[model samples]
Target: MNILNIDLYSILIAYIGIALILAKIMGSLFEKYRLPAVLGEILTGVFLGSSFISIFSPSLSWFYKDPEFHYPLEHIGHIGILLLLFISGLETDVRTLKKTGKVATISTVMGVITPFILGYIAGILMGYSNQTSMVLGALLTATSIGVTARTMMDLGVLSSDVGTASLSASVMDDFLGIIAIILAIGASSIISLAIVGVNMLLLIVLELMVGMLVIKYIMRAMEKIKTTKAILGMSFGLMLLFAAFSQMTVQAAIEGAFFAGIIIGTTAESKIINDDVKAIAYGFFIPMFFVYIGSLINLQVFTNMKAIILAVVIVIIAIVGKVIGRAVGAKMGGFNWKQSLQMGIGSIPRMEVALVSIMIAIKGGAVKGELADIFLAATMIFVTVTTLITPPLLKWSFKDEIQQNGG
Candidate 1:
């Protein structure tokens, strides 16, 4: 191990706090610009990235720069992402979505498959081995449902047909993404009985079934409490418990949270949980996830023209490949050109999800730091670009509706 000179704990505290504050500023600034809050977070991260920060802090050391510092908050980010997913699932209108579910499902499936294939093709062309290319495809398949959910909510369209359809689509998108991960994780074909790889597929399905049963029974047992806080708090606590038990995969915890929220419904305290917890979540923890992602980019590698070009090329293909892939899919699913484009743009951000995959790949020894860095940088760039672009595109497409609603 390399001898560490800097105080990692202190540096983490300083960095996390400063990062949160800046994220808030960036979020607000984006909101002011009529952009998605997610856009602000990503741009804040990109703007305050380690590359830019290093110019002034040459004396500062890479402490959390190592993987260990990532663990604690990485876990927390998982929690945040879980909560984000659950809250989003809670807000989804299942009945309306079931009506258009066919379109949404088809669109979402195509979104993942096309991106994966395109990313894989890009990988092979870029000289990545088959395993590397497969992992890259898996990385591209990660969709940020959190971004679209929050955007829909802010636009007061969460209950709209478009919002409902998008939510349902993302549900399938996440599920398919999980399976893509399994395939990628097992690309080397060394499966353990510990259920680390293929077993994940089984467990994810089982977790959803168990979560539904548990939520159905437990919710009825509650008898509709006077306030949602107490009940939701209990449910949230339960979510944490199950999440701890399901360390087999972050996908387990994520799907666990979604089912927990879905069974809880959005009527009573789901809104309350979202309001109370989102402040801490979107405000602090989630930004730390993005910033940590940004910090992973080592500018020293940029001195290598090959690495820089590879990173940029991957980022470009990530965007173009997914957009083109999903656009046709959405169009086939009855979306107009604009909605199809929005769906494509909406599916683009891949921060926490890709990070989770990267961590898994690294641990499983399927990928290394350079490839991981390439994926991470590519993901961050994709996220930043899409988050900034999607909101306006959405707003423009829905402007007539927004105007009619007096919003």
Candidate 2:
């Protein structure tokens, strides 16, 4: 076989095999240490990707050098993200979400505004151009719903008040962040913010209309499927279709997968579907997604002191800003200080949503040159730190409750 026509199938097979094995080993090890399994998966990626790959296995440099292998693995990892969110959507208690709706809204709004303002100020104070500052602000506004959701599930609090509020707030957090990203990018481009705002509103309306129509059709079709295998197949197909559609029309495919799960969750068979989704997702897809997130981290920019300082400042603002904002919002919503703080801590992780926006801003020249690399590295660091912190904070926050339950 010619070098130009390398065996894509073998590469993919090897990648999956390696990813799954590492994810399982690391995931189990983390669980053994009383840490979140996803953390281990992500660490595995960090150990293998841009950060530490060359140190351990220079021969494997071809993995990242070849776009053919890299891009497909990324796509597969993205599928994992979609499946995780879809499963989350399936398990989401809509009634609980509605009960916490007002608080979730308030928390999400504060979560977006405070971090954004703080990030913008920090950037400007650091002498970055206003355009770059605004993009930095936009990046700070993201809340990684999947990461937080996983933590809540791991802690067995996904259905609790703080957990539900966190999940609900994340939806709003992602929504507002998406809008901010559009505005920030628009400020740098020929397009006016007003035009971008209008386009965003239109996109939301269109997504809602199309999502509802497709979901309804899927629900009815699912009713006709009798066998377990057929139902599972139908469920997976619908999830993939909706996820792809969401990517095409919206900011993220997970958004569509989530809503698709919500639609299926309304059916009598939803519990069965949820279990099935969980089995496949946790076993493979979701772990791959987190590991892929780690793989994207490049610490090469850390050598720049200015970038490092800016990154540290931004991380501080990101962490403190979210805690203060969401804690206040949670307090206003009648949560006790413990629950409120839990909510704040839960809001801290920023992953795919922020990353996608940052990548776009970099490509669009909103954040230029070495600054972009530095910012990217910083975001990855804090996201990892936040992910590491949440589970332990959550356990601490629920100590009394857990003790009372005799755990």
The local lDDT score (0 to 100) that residue 282 gets in candidate 1 is 68
Candidate 1, 37-122: lDDT as tens digits: 65566556655565766687845546445666657656665566666666656666667456657667777777788878887888
TM per candidate comes to 0.72, 0.74
> Which stretch of 10 consecutive residues in model 2 shows the poorest summed lDDT?
246-255
How far residue 273's Cα lies from its native spot in candidate 2, in Å, is: 2.8
| lDDT (Cα, tens digit) per residue for candidate 2, span 122-200 | 8789888777888888888877766667767866778898988887787667657766875777664325556666765
lDDT of each: 0.65, 0.74
Model 1 Cα displacement at 101 (Å)?
Answer: 4.3
Number of clashing pairs, model 1? 0
Best-fitting candidate, scored by TM-score: 2
How high is the lDDT of residue 178 in model 1?
55
